[model samples]
Target: MPEFAPIHLLYLALAIVLEIAANVLMKFSAGFTRKLPAMTAIVCALAAFTALSYAIEGIQLSVAYGIWGGVGLIATAILGITLFGERLRPSGWLGLALILGGVVLLKFS
Candidate 1:
């Protein structure tokens, strides 16, 4: 793995959290009809992007964004299934596993 500062990792981690929060808020916002959730979603999205920008200063943008997006996508999928009772078929599970593999490869690349 290429070396990266702790602060860069911190920023990337926060970016993933903020992005996940934004997606969850948007889901609860129900097409933005719910005012508070809609506004919070907007804020989270902005913060996520801001953190991503900072992360790229130390971490390569390709690596940072790939990890950020992959992890966020995986977490969101889990939350959707758990909290919203969404279903995933065998194909979906395979896709998630592929994403996990890609993320690990990206980290070591």
Candidate 2:
């Protein structure tokens, strides 16, 4: 297989951002009761998936998915804590750390 290019990583980054935005919009959707946020969330999620598909064309699926999910989870958790007044337990912090480490390893592998 050909080595991954910088553009693939950029696509992955875009995917991650869009995914996070989708998640936040979904939260604002109030169980899909809010039409605008709910619809926008769906659009953002579809776009994110499209970007992820492009990223996987160059990057290994495992690495691309690992980083995509790990970073998305980490960022969403931070947003939840800050924007939603959510709290994470000590174990949750540890889990986030493990996820970060896994993403780092995947990037270098």
lDDT of each: 0.96, 0.96
Q: Residues 63-93, candidate 2, lDDT per residue (tens digit)?
A: 9999999999999999999999999999999
In candidate 2, which residue ranges exceed 4 Å CA deviation? 1-3
Tell me the deviation in Å of residue 45 in model 2.
0.5
User: Taking the tens digit of each residue's C-alpha lDDT, what string does model 1 give over 2-97?
Assistant: 999999999999999999999999999999999999999999999999999999999998899999999999999999999889999999999999
- TM-score of candidate 1 against the unseen true structure: 0.98
Residue 10, candidate 1: Cα error in Å is 0.3
CA displacement after TM-score superposition, residue 37 of candidate 2 (Å): 0.5
Q: After superposition, how far is residue 15 of candidate 1 from its true place, in Å?
A: 0.1
Winner by lDDT: 1
